[model samples]
Target: MKKNIYSLLKGKFLTSNGASQNWVMIFYLLTLAIVTIGSSHSADQKVHEIAKLNNEVKELRSIMIDGRGQLMKLKKESYLEKKMGEKGIAISEIPPHKIKVKSQKE
Candidate 1:
């Protein structure tokens, strides 16, 4: 009977309003809230930076894609053959291309 009463008393003490379980739960909630706020702040900044880089990549791709046809035309063998024929070593009819640029109007 004494042991039974002592067990009951111990149960009441450990399960009262000031129980260790309640304090531990409160601390866990507080820590979760703090970590959530910290991760949100860092993730928000990273998202903004990723969006900026994506926009920059889009702009550069637009610039690079602008002259696809002209680039293909310049890279053709026909243009190279024509240029080589013009600067042919067989005949000296045409004037040699000079690096110095003289104004056409002057």
Candidate 2:
């Protein structure tokens, strides 16, 4: 067992005649490690992309809300009257009265 340990520590197994299987196993482990690293990197990139999109969505939502608020302010009766007053257009002093007509073809 001491000899085996010493040989293993000295890396003799990699150079021995029966080390083809060990080489294959080493290459397989390396391939798996590389694939795992690539998958992890892909996942991390997707997570970053999702986070960036979320931030963009939040920004757009805030902008939309601000635009809606501005539109509401512009559409208010008081605001319209103020702007129209600046343009020399005054509101009529008389309140509107509805007129009803009776049909003769009853």
Candidate 3:
């Protein structure tokens, strides 16, 4: 047991006659490590992409809210009256009368 441990510590197993198995295991572990690193990088990129999209969504939502606010202000009766007055269009002093049309039966 002690001789086996000494041989392992001294890197003798890599040079011995049965070292092909050790080399295969080393290659397998290296491949697994590379795959693990690649998967982690892909996950990190997706997380960053989600964060960027979230920020863009928030910005667009705020812009939409701001546009709605401006539209509401523009649609106000007071604002329309002022603009129309500036354009020399005066409001009617008389109340509007709705005429009801009766359909003729044949």
lDDT of each: 0.85, 0.98, 0.97
lDDT of 1 by residue, 34-68 (tens): 99999999999999999999999999888888778
Write candidate 3's Cα lDDT for 1-106 as tens digits: 9998998899998998999999999999999999999999999999999999999999999999999999999999999999999999988999999998888983
- Residue pairs with clashing backbones, model 2: none
**Which window of ten consecutive residues has the lowest lDDT sum in model 2?**
97-106
Find the candidate with the highest TM-score and give its number.
3
Ranking by TM-score: 3, 2, 1
What does candidate 2 score on TM?
Answer: 0.82
User: Could you tell me the lDDT of residue 93 within candidate 3?
Assistant: 100
Global Cα RMSD, each model: 9.8, 2.6, 2.2
Error of 3 at 85 (Å): 0.4
Per-model TM-score on C-alpha atoms = 0.45, 0.82, 0.84
